[model samples]
Each structure stands twice: as structure tokens, then as C-alpha cells.
Target: MSLLDHLSEHHLLVKYTTKNEMEEETRDEGNIRKEDQCNTVKGLKKNWQKWANNHSEYQKHNPFSNNRTVTVQFQKGEEGYGRPREGSRTQQRGHSAHAHLEKEVDELCMIIKSIGEAGGDGQTRVAFGPLFERYVPISNKLVGVLLRARKHGRISFEGEMLWQRRDDDVIITLLE
Candidate 1:
């Protein structure tokens, strides 16, 4: 057989001794350090409550600003116009793929810039006040997942074959 099987086959004495000896071995290194540092299953609930309290305070102190102007722009990288015009199926797959690439690029650029400013360590978390602290981690993780996905699989529209071909090319134009 194999090394493990051979050992078990012959070494009956060791197996019997080993099983009983290790059975009572204390594996629960509970909180190894202290309440603040050691995060475990039991600690998760405890820490979450603490974090919840801090977050509540943060929200109370810093109200969200409604005065900031949101300007939507259109181009490859910026938020507004890069997206394909709505309801147009022309090169939909290609457009979507490019859009995904552009989005990933933008996200990576932002993360890298942040990381650089944060000294390339996981130490300083940026705070655009409390609003950013709440969303940055989740947003970073989402972008990371998307970027990783783009590396392997191709994005394409699969289902729904709509619009039969006309005798000549049928061109439709949309106005914004």
C-alpha cells in the first residue's frame, strides 16, 4: 500500500496508543492573547458589537453632505458617457467587454493610488469621512474580484437573439 497504510497495517501498538493519548489534548487556544487582538468565532460577535457602537458614533458626528455637486461626464474612463447608448444592440458584447476593462482599470488605478498614499501597507485606511469608511473595503473587494475575473473569462451577452435581419442593413439612431 502507501506509507500511511503500511504504518497502520503493522504498527497497531502505536495507533492504539496515539489515538488515546491525543484525545484529551486541549486544542482550544481561547483568545490566545486578549479581547482586543485575538479574533475568533466567539470574538467575532463581540468585536462586531464594539464596531457597531463606534460606527454609530461616527455617523452621529459626521452628517452626510448634500451640498457636494455631482457632475456626470462622458468619455472612456470617467463615469458618464463611456457606456453604450441605451437600447442599442450594436456591438453590445464588445462594448460591454471594453466597458468592463475600463472599469477594472479605473478601480485598479484608484486602489493603487490609495495604497501608495497609505504607504503600501494595510495600516492607514482612508476616510472620506464615515461615508467612505463604510464602503471602501467592500468596493475594493468587488473591484478586485472583477479584475481577477477579467483575467480569465471573456464577458459576452449569451441569450436572446433579437431582431431578424432586413434585406439591407437596418440602422436605428437614438437621441439623448
Candidate 2:
């Protein structure tokens, strides 16, 4: 967590607690002077503004224009091609998993469109069996991508969640 996030929530607990609890908590956490926090925040803002004001020419210093392959996962302390050193928080899980998300989604869409059965409402629907069998080889992150696509209203499935082999017959419909 950043200093900003820590400062916001840490100070709120003492305000809500009883006198005894507050005193105990304060003793445990140690006393933090508000002035020090304010000065630190101000210093950060001033430094950031100074850096932001100096806009170098794009032709001279364009980081993204570099041509090199960058792998997804690397052990801590190793840097990749053209990657920023900005203290990235997300490490193992979440956003790091979806490298070729667009291609995966396109392949999934094409697979469902090809093998899906027609529903009574005239929508193309495929069983989880076909999707799993076909897509797992293409991209092992099929389930995660499916959840992402569903979150964005691209597809709809009938159940709380889909399971391998168990929910093979569960129908999943591609939303047009």
C-alpha cells in the first residue's frame, strides 16, 4: 500500500474507538505527527509536479517505440525489455495472467460460434464440454478469460460457476 492509502485508513480507526482502545492502539502503532505526514505528502506532490513539467521531445525519448519481446513472469529484481520501474504492485495473480487476452477471446468466440448448438431463443450456445476441450489447448486460462468476458457482458452461462467434467453439459451462450 502507498503512504496515501495507509494514512487514510490508519487514522480513521482511532477516531471511532473508545478512549481506552484509542490509547492502546496509539501506543502499539506509535504516535505519528500530522505535520510530518502533511510535509511528506507536499514534498511528494512538489517532486511529481517538477518532473511532470519537463516534457522532453517524444522523438528523443520514446520508451514504447522500442522493439523487443517481453515475457510475462520473471523472478523479482529482474527487469524486462522497455518495462517501467514504477514499483508495480500486482505480481503473481490478476492482470499478469492475461498476456494474449485479445487473441484468446477471439479464438474462444470462434470456437463457440463453430461448435455451439442453437437455443430456443435463436441464440448460439455451446456446452462447457466443447469449450473446455477445444480452448484448454489454445489457452490454459480459459476459465479466467470466460469470467472476464462474462464480466464485460460478452457471454452468459447458467450457473454460479463452471467445473471441469462435472459441469460439462452446462450451456454457455455468446452474447452478440
Candidate 3:
């Protein structure tokens, strides 16, 4: 049934003791809906922090002159936005950055297998030249992804480091 119908049926039936109380209940329900509808939107400020121990300039950086998306913050005592209401599905589906990173690693593997040459040993291998040319267009963080893939034993290379021009001939083989 529709929302209004469900609320009218259930909301009224659940506590139908007297006619006067029913009128009060209806008014309270309307007020609750009005409060829910009148929401406030605010732009988020960028928060920046530097790693004091890290020496790399990359680690010591902050947000640049980019206009990021506005975010929502649910304040405490405001019912904490009363969200994901106890055992709700949204509450159960937690977020994980590693899960997405792992998916990127898997995509990297797919790109290698698709573009790379196949060996008689039934392994797919691609040179750094081809892989870089192909993968860089998909994601600029190709080196980081490659390193992650290697760490997961998904792909193997010969060197400790794979630089752009220097390691162009480095063969990245997908391990079974």
C-alpha cells in the first residue's frame, strides 16, 4: 500500500483508544513529517593535515584549489540523524576502502590478461610498455596498483622498481 495509506491504517489503528486521542495523534504525525521534509543543506569545509613524520612531499600535502562536493554531518543529540535505524540494511552494509582497492587490483589483472601476450606455459604476460600505455589511461596510479597486485601475488615482475622509461621492457606476468 501507499505510505499515507499505511500510516493512516497502522498509525491510527495501533493506538485507537479514543476519538480525541486519534485527532492528537494525527496532528503529531503531520508535524513529524513536516520536520522530516524541512531539511538543511550546508557546504562542507576541506580538512587538511600533514604527516609530521613523513619526509615525502606527497605525504605533506593538503587539499588544493578544488571545489569538492558538499557533505552532510549528522550532529549528536539530533538523533545522530536517526539514520540506519537499528539493524537496518544500510547499517549492515559497511564501507571498506580495501574492498574497492582489491577490485582495482582485479581490474589491473584483467587489463593485463586482455592486452598481454600469452605464453606456451598458459600464463599471460605483458611488457611494461604495453601495460603502462594501456593502464595509465584507465588510472594514473598504475604503479601503486601494480605494487598492490604484486603484493597480492596476482602479478609478478623482475625488478624492485618499475620506472616509466627505464623499465619499459619489464615483463609483468599474471601468476595462477
Candidate 4:
């Protein structure tokens, strides 16, 4: 049922016993509200640090670092502001940098495909599936190769197909 219905059914508002005592009871509840909020903040920060450490370990090779270094500093009695600052550099430049990086990565993939498709000697055709599958196992290595190929204006699609293959049976089965 809805929160209002549940509270009404439990006689939550009737706890004062009489109408005259309602204001006094509400004031008592208000007094402990800040303590509850402080406890919640501490709990949330503890959970965040735990999860952030795990994330940093998993994505160790990622250029973008996880929030392992994130600090949650708040006064004992203060409820910190949750809203973003309108004039912050993080709000303005950060978004543009993120968008630019995404576009660059997408372009790199397209370039890799083009290079892989056009064989230098013009012989047998290279398939994308097998290449993508093989490359995924050594993604760190493959990323380096792609970066080098991009510099020379070549998109290496030769192993693109291999990277697409699912070497992990667990992941493939989950999708099925």
C-alpha cells in the first residue's frame, strides 16, 4: 500500500494520545532528524569507499581512474550541499573533454576497420569477427596497436571481427 495508507493504518499520527500533545511530539521527532541524517551520511561514505576500491582494481588498465581517491569530507552536524556549482570548470570543460574523447575512440574504430579491410598485397579478404575475438583477449595490446595504426592513417579492421567474438562462455550464455 501507499506510505500515507500504511502510516494511517499503523496509527502513526495517533501516538500523541491527544490533539494538545501533537506539537510537542512532532518537535521531539524533529530533534532526532539531524542525528538520523548524520548517521546516513556516514553509512553512505563507508559504502562508497568500499565499492570504489573494488572498481579501481578491476579497471586498473583504464586511462580513467576510479573513485578510489575520492574524499567525502563533511562536518558532523552538517548536511552537505548535493547540487553542482554552475560556474565550475568540471561542469563546463569536463563535459566537452568527455565528448571529444568518445568521438576520437569511435573514429579510431572506424579507421581500424578500413585498414583491416584493405589488404596491402590485395589478396585474401580479412573477416572482422575472428579478428575482434582474438583482439579482445589482449585488449590492452590491441588498444596499443589500434592507436599506432590510427597515427599512420590506417584503420586496422583485419582483427576487428576477432575482437567481436565471445571468448567468455559465461557472458555469451547469459545473453542467450
Best by lDDT: 3
Supply every candidate's count of residue pairs whose N, Cα or C atoms clash at under 3 angstroms.
1, 0, 0, 22
The CA lDDT of each predicted structure is 0.43, 0.74, 0.76, 0.51
Off by over 4 Å in 3: 1-95
Give the per-residue lDDT digits (tens) of candidate 2, residues 1-176. Answer: 99967886787764656778766876865677778768987999998887665433222334364524442444566775445434443333334555557567767878888988878887889989988998888778888788877887888998777899999998899986
Which clashing pairs does model 1 show?
Answer: 74-81
lDDT of 3 by residue, 47-145 (tens): 122332332342223124243534344677786375654553455664355677888999999998899889999999999988899888889989999
Give the lDDT of residue 172 in candidate 1.
Answer: 14
Q: What TM-score fits each model?
A: 0.20, 0.44, 0.49, 0.23
**What is the Å distance of residue 112 in model 1 from its true position?**
1.5
The residue-by-residue lDDT of candidate 1 on 1-176, one tens digit each, is 88967886676655446665545432433425665343575688988999989666544433263424443335576763455435446458778877886676455445434542332333323222331333356564532433343344422112222122221122111110
lDDT of 4: 0.51
Candidates 2 and 3 compared by lDDT, better number: 3
Q: Over the stretch 68-105, how does candidate 4's per-residue lDDT look in tens digits?
A: 55444455666744423355565688679768655655
Runs of candidate 1 with Cα error greater than 4 angstroms are: 1-90, 117-176
What is the model-wide C-alpha lDDT for candidate 2?
A: 0.74
